[model samples]
Target: MKYKIVNINDTGVRSVLIIYTGGTFGMIQDASGSLAPFNFGKVVDRVPELRQLDIKLTVISFPKPIDSSNIGIQDWKDMSYIIEENYAQYDAFVILHGTDTMAYSASMLSYMLEGLNKPIIFTGAQMPIGSIRSDARENLIAALEIASAHNNGNPIISEVCVYFNYLLLRGSRSQKLRSSTFAAFESENYPVLAEAGIEIEFNYAALKPHDENAQLNVINNLDANVTILKIFPGITEHSVKSILSDPQIKGVVLESFGSGNTMNFDWFIDCLIKAIEGGKIILNVSQCIGGEVEQGRYETSKKLNEIGVLSGGDITTEAAVTKMMFLLGSVEDVNEVKKKLTYSLAGEMDMMEE
Candidate 1:
């Protein structure tokens, strides 16, 4: 990947680095007319809107851009290392990622980069840039503008965020909900930090303010020994037991039926109890797209609570998985990991007040 310095005429401009990590936004048609990943460094020529922005821009492409479906812990580490290594040299950072796992990457990056006082904006498009009606140009251009936006000589947004369609959302709180529409992501429980219209209207109170004195630190080690158990009607105990008893599995996300309800069978309770006793961390999250998990309200869910399943209130699946990995990496004791799962470390979960 080659990078060149591009100059802008507007004054008060700062440099922002756009890191391209393979996605639909960077895809182009080949000779056979099949969509394939293209070198992102060539995007500037295709989308001239970038030149309209006052900020100086630089591009960095992953040596081997990966499809979002194939993204893993190693990819997360690689992206974090780039930001960590270049934190001081740039004013802010923008990442072009696939929408399929954009929320997961954004959430993981939020936890991995602690005390970060610079903007880390993640954006992508559902359609390729070469298409006639591509949403890529606006998303990419606006992301750069948001990343470079400053107030009182400080970056306006100091936290990790996702910019898509016309809204800016907290990275950890967003999820990709649509497949064919221009508005492909949503922040279920949180409000938009900023909205782009004729003019960008920033909700001042919603933005994460910069803490100039804080030093950026990256948590590179992520544990992948976690599993998700999504509950459905007629789920068998044998299937559940096999997953829990797996020697390599260290954490489990139990996606319970609406509001964290589960089958109250004796064998089901016994399997969960044995798993908890064996030091496996179990977290109960609601299956509904917009509700919080309430584990002790019903008889079925009460069994889950009694057996030591932690409740994940109003957390998206993407946030839950990354949070589990984050906790698994930071904590050494199994008890501590369980406790932290219930607690909101990066504002990933909304805890109901007593």
Candidate 2:
């Protein structure tokens, strides 16, 4: 069944700001035989479904919308700035972003907007919204609805999240799982915070509560001096040594094998040890799509645990990168940064059961 937005003209009408940051969702075929972003103000009128929602939506397009692939740390800062500048003016925010880097952007925003008390829903389409069979309309309409949904005069979700298909996932835990399917993202470690079926079902316990008294803080400074090292069966000592020896690098994410297992070679262990001693923060994250990083669970990973490599239990790569950046940017003390990496900030990690 096709999803349609239901209009509500009661006193509870919500006002939302839709930031169009260019993606397939806003593209249309131009006369020159190329796809370009049309004005969203005009684009919205074509979608009759939007009017049904009865919410006041304000479209704020970027000077030139960027593809999600080109999104970088600066883009994240800009998005945060926009929200911070207009925080009290809108009830919720809906970011129309591209799917390629949407998860990463969402995760970064989750950290940037710490202590958030309003809904920030990031969503985009697999197909262009102008297409006859586009997934854009449903995704956009539902995202706005979710953003506007409140309980007892307060917003339901107070954290950054991605709404795709029918599920609302914590941004830090979401990953794009499919290239072709409409159900493109999955939160492997965390359950759905909310689901949109015949009726929107919200797991209230799973939702991040709002603290109205806490002042909203926006963290824009992000350090990108981080590297990701993936371990392989026949990786050479030279490759591992070189990566660890980089003088400018501040952090490393070791994507080890199942259960965070790595090579038991002495040289490999020594390289990691030296890097850590040189003030480089190293975190061990599992290569598996849906498992925790147990550094000491196996003989191969025991050395990593002994040497004080941080454990990233079931956190996605997107979250690992942004979390490192956020921590590195905010804290000058390396030891304190290491401690926070292991802690569950913003529901990014699952607590290991004793």
- What is the model-wide C-alpha lDDT for candidate 1? 0.86
> lDDT tens digits, residues 218-287, model 2?
9887899999999998999999988999999999999999989999998899999999999999988888
- The clash count for each model shown is 0, 0
TM-score for all predictions? 0.95, 0.94
Tens-place lDDT per residue, model 1, 142-235, is 8888898889999999999999998999999999999989999998788789999888889888776678998888987789999999878888
Distance from true location, Cα of 128 in model 1, Å: 0.4
Candidate 2 collision pairs: none
The true-versus-predicted C-alpha distance at residue 58 of model 2, in Å, is: 0.6
The count of residue-pair clashes in candidate 2 stands at: 0
After superposition on all C-alphas, the RMSD of every candidate to the true structure, in Å, is 2.3, 4.6
The TM-score that candidate 2 achieves is 0.94
**Where is model 2 more than 4 Å wrong at Cα?**
1-12, 352-354
